[model samples]
Target: MTTGFETDRISRRKAIWREIPAGIWALGFVSLLMDVSSEMIHALLPVYMVTVLGTSALTVGMIEGVAEATASITKMFSGALSDWLGKRKLLAALGYGLAAFTKPIFPLAPSVGWLIAARFIDRIGKGIRGAPRDALVADISPAHLRGASFGLRQSLDTIGAFFGPLLAIALMWLTANQFSAVFWIAVIPGFLSFVLILVAVREPKRPEGLRRIRMPFSRSELGRLGAAYWWVVAVAAVFTLARFSEAFLVLRAQSIGLPLMLVPAVLVIMNIAYAISAYPVGVLSDRIDRVTVLIVGLFLLLAADLLLAFAPGAIGLVLGVVLWGLHMGFTQGLLATLIADAAPAELRGTAFGMFNLVTGLALLIASVTAGALWDATGPQGTFLAGAVFTLLTLIGLLPVQTRLGKREAS
Candidate 1:
């Protein structure tokens, strides 16, 4: 039933997906499905809230603010609990399972308050699961290959991003903007991800000689390990301030006379760019320092923000979107790897959780701030703000880049 092209396509996928340990590849598959489920609801949430639920922009901002902040706070706790308990996979599974359980509620929600409730539950699940899952990926892979492994996960996740929107668009077309209908269908992929995560992944042993007794300030993650990580977090928050939501991009594209129907195509293009760059960039991070690779990614993002700020038309938007995708490839796994290197294995879950918590919180703030800035000035001002954040991030990371380089040399 398959042609040569189909066979080749299948073979290439098998190899790329295996860049992580086989179990992580499996996790990637789970993420792919979960992302599909998520985007199905999330990509349209703002629009749905505005049009169907009659919510205001500030309400949407508040929902995202509350949800993301909740995720961040929970991530730290979950990660720490995983560290204390010395279990990664079980917590990770529970996290995904909780998110899975919450998916259906969104479609059935009668009011914006209900939607916010469902979103909070889902993001709480996200906060809990993300750190452990990332720690598992780090636990299994060799240090040299960490970047590539996480990259593979990112690549797979991006594939989900591409599919979720297309499916949502088709569902939107068929249902005639029945957003609730799309939400119901999204439940399928969410549960599928939960199931696959349970069935497919296995936890490896804790890293060797991990001290069981909690450390004092000198030995605590909050001390030596915490400083650089916190710096990275602060700088990343700055970058987040610059970036804001991609919805702004979609709105911009549409405002400039790109057909409303074709905006999803632009999203598809960016996801493709992300999928293409993730694996190689990840592999590159393994060979070099994660910071070096991260720098490259951030620079790419800086360029992307600048492009979007002054984008002239469809072509400019396409270019800017692609760059943004490339930036994703750079940062996604790179964040995981950085924590792995800085924190001991026992503390990995906490490290990743903290990283995400900080960045996610930053996003919540940035998105709300961006909206206000847009209301006050314009979209161009919004993106120009992002450019400034990226510049500051680069400066903050310079010392870490030097340290990471030294680690690579050793």
Candidate 2:
């Protein structure tokens, strides 16, 4: 059944896969395990907060926004430290270790305050490790395979994201909907993730002529990142305003009469689509214009927002979730690839840190606004607002799309 062209294509794809560095693969798996641990708790946390703790939708949004913003803020400093020390793995290990230790708190927390503190501490760990880990991937990857590398890591991480929810769903069923019991089981994978990264990931040696920077965030050092890099950050911040936290997706599903036990299925479906599309889209970007791919992603999100806003019944909800996942697959890794392409190697950590900082802050604003809209005009308003933002982002991309292509070609 296989034609010669098909055979050639398959062989080439395998060759590209083999070309990716072992260190990138190790990093991907490390992300996989951590995401598995994190998602298991997160998949249930929103519903638990709303139902068990009597928290409002607005409150949930605030908590999620604060948690992510904290992580992003921390990334800036941790990223700079990694650059200054010229050591990424140690900081990465510390971050993962801190997150691992925080896992028990989720099950043990007796009040909303305690749960908030746990989430806060957990995000700090995520923040500490995020930039350095991303920078490490960029360092290990071949320039030609950069898109594929980030895509592969994202794909692996999303696999864990879906798996975590599936595990939570199963445990909920077996334990008779015992939320604490499921949280307790989630702790094991978090520790495993920490251990895997500590042992398996090896930092590449610094290049012979590379100089260590004492102040990565100083005016002069930041200037080195250039207009092209800053443009990527600006466009990314606009794009982030369209996409809020995944917690809203859970709420949407629950609003439609999905049973509590099956709520995690929302993430399961979205992540499957995300996991399936991410690597292929990444590989596609390697061959085409990345900005074009990103534009396509924006369209997908627009469609998803429209569907989530106006579509009828369970089928509509599932379809919208799938499109949302696909959009994430198309855009997320490519954005990282863009950053890696634009920035000089020496400042990659700082570049990623700044990018995360901007996007993270944007996300906080979006989440809080979405929550307020949910309270005022219902879920429809929240999603329609997302659609409007997505359109604005599409318009914003017009001026930069050609420039992004030119920059990547250079």
Candidate 3:
């Protein structure tokens, strides 16, 4: 039933898959395992905090914001260290190890303070690994396959994201809705992730004639990142303002009369859409203008926000979640790819660090604002605010579209 054109297309896709480095695949798997471990706890944490601990939505938002901000700040330093030491894998392994060890604390925490501390420490580990791991992927992948590589890694990570929730849902059913028991089981995968990264990932050798940089964050070194890179960061920070944390998604689902045991299904559904769309979108961006693709992603987010704000019933909620995931798939890897394309190889770690720093801070502001809105005006206001921000981001992208296109052509 396959035509010649279809056969050629299939062969091309196979060739692209084969062209990705083994190390990238290893890194992807590493991400997959860690996300699996993290999401299992996170999918349940918001509801647990609200219901079991008697925390307010505002408190949950504050905790999530602070946790993420801490991670972002840590990334800046850890990323610089990775650049100075020229050993991404060592820092990466150390990060994952720290996270893995911290997993038990989630189940053991007796109070909100202890839970906050655990989440804080866990995010620090995430921060430590994030930039270096991304830089490692950029280093390993050929320039031509950069989009595909990041997409593949993101798809793999999201697969774990969905799987984690599914496992949590299943465990909740089996354990009679015992949250602590599910958290305990989540510890196993975290350790597995740490071990896999330590053993499986092979760092590429540094290129000849590549000078070792002593100060990745020095003024002169930062100047080397250029206007193009900063523009990408600025746009990304603004875009992040529209997205907020996924915790809100869980809250929204619960608000609609979804049972406690099925709450994790919200993440399960969104991540499934995210996992499915990421790779194909990445490939499409590789062949077209990345900025155009990003603009489309913005539109998707806008649509999601509108639907989440005004859509009726369970079907509407599910549709909005899918759109949210699709937007993530279209944009997340592309942003990383943009950073890799813009920054000098020597400064990649620093570039990613700085980029995340700005966006993470933006997310903090957005989450806090969203929580306040949710408390004062309900979920409708929170999501409508998101839609407004999404529109602003779309407008902001106008000036930079030509520049991004020229960069892609170059």
Candidate 4:
């Protein structure tokens, strides 16, 4: 016989699960498989480039920055096309397929140029899927469960993020640190992700009354997105600037005397924290004030930046990485939910495209800057710059935070 409290808790869990559409669950697993594929390679790429290929830190940074920017830029077109076609799953599958094909390239790269080309194509696939996939999630989800839905996807994604690194660590040991063998194993999951998406994901039918617009980017259509969506975009771009690429985190772990084989543990630890917290934070956002949650995330990033900047040993390094994960857990899903909340459903693909585009460009700049700073002043300087930018972002958020409070109060 369950106690009253236990029964109530069990019922609530069931209710939340019931609210999320099957498509979302399918999408979550698709993301989980894809992350597993990507992370296995990414967990080790930075070190592979630097130690094996003899690429400089700045060069590594530039590669990562460009790779991410390529993905972001691609989303603008893919997302707009999804809106025009009123079909998301096809484009999403195409993107995943492209990425799946690119997985083999990672193991074959004999030079930095080849590596760059492979990464570029892989990111292109990511760009193609990102906006439409997000918009689709928004489309399928009920309004009340929006936060939980995004959180669920993010949590599943982070599960891959951690698992990828864990596999890399295991393979490293098994192969006596043979990088190419692990890269080869990663290819399996990439194709699996594409198959899962095709079989499992069901896009919501276009609303019967929707005016199918040919020009998703026309000024009038853009105007329909309104001020609220743009505000979220601006703040997210600044946040992107503050955070830069996680490649730096891998490098940071290496800097603190972390062994080459053990470095994936940094991502493993961070993603564990991320996977655990994302759903809970999402549930919290649905219940309380979201801006407050965003602020909390920003502060966590601040702490992470500061900790990474001044940490004296391995313990400090791990702590900083955990804080970084916590910040990601708190804010990433919330931002997606906010975009869904702010945008008109018909224009959601465009809304997400524009949002990702701006932030993606910001990421490009931030990564380059971080790399340049590392070249000039070492790792400390890179993280210190991040701390300053995070502080600025907090100050910038004050007005937004105030308005959120007033709106709720009224």
Candidate 2 overall lDDT versus native: 0.90
TM-score per prediction, in order, is 0.88, 0.91, 0.91, 0.88
For model 4, the superposed segments whose C-alpha errors exceed 4 Å read 1-7, 44-63, 106-117, 176-180, 259-261, 375-381, 398-410
- Computed on alpha carbons, the lDDT of every model, listed in order, comes to 0.82, 0.90, 0.89, 0.89
> Can you write out model 3's per-residue Cα lDDT over 1-410, one digit (the tens) per residue?
99999999999999999988888888888888888899889979998988998989999978987887889999988888889998899988888998999889988988888888889989999999999999998999998889999999999999998898888888999999999999999999899989998788889999988778898888999998877888889889888989998879989988888888677678778888999999888888788877899999999999999998899878889999999999999999999998998888888999989988999899988988998999999889999999999898888777667666666578
Off by over 4 Å in 3: 45-63, 107-117, 177-181, 254-263, 406-410
After superposition on all CA atoms, how large is the RMSD of candidate 4?
3.1
Tens digit per residue, CA lDDT, model 2, 285-370: 98988888999999999999999998988899999999999999999999999998888888999998999999988988888889
lDDT of 2 at 367: 83
Instruction: List residue ranges in candidate 2 displaced over 4 A.
Output: 45-63, 107-116, 177-181, 254-262, 406-410
For candidate 4, the lDDT comes to: 0.89
Q: Which pairs of residues collide in candidate 3?
A: none
Candidate 4 lDDT for residue 142: 88
- Please report how far candidate 2 places residue 7 from its true position, in Å: 0.7
**Which 10 consecutive positions of candidate 3 have the poorest summed lDDT?**
399-408
TM-score of candidate 1 to 2 decimals? 0.88
| Residue 138 accuracy (lDDT) in model 4 | 95
- Per-residue error for 155 in candidate 4, Å, reads 1.0
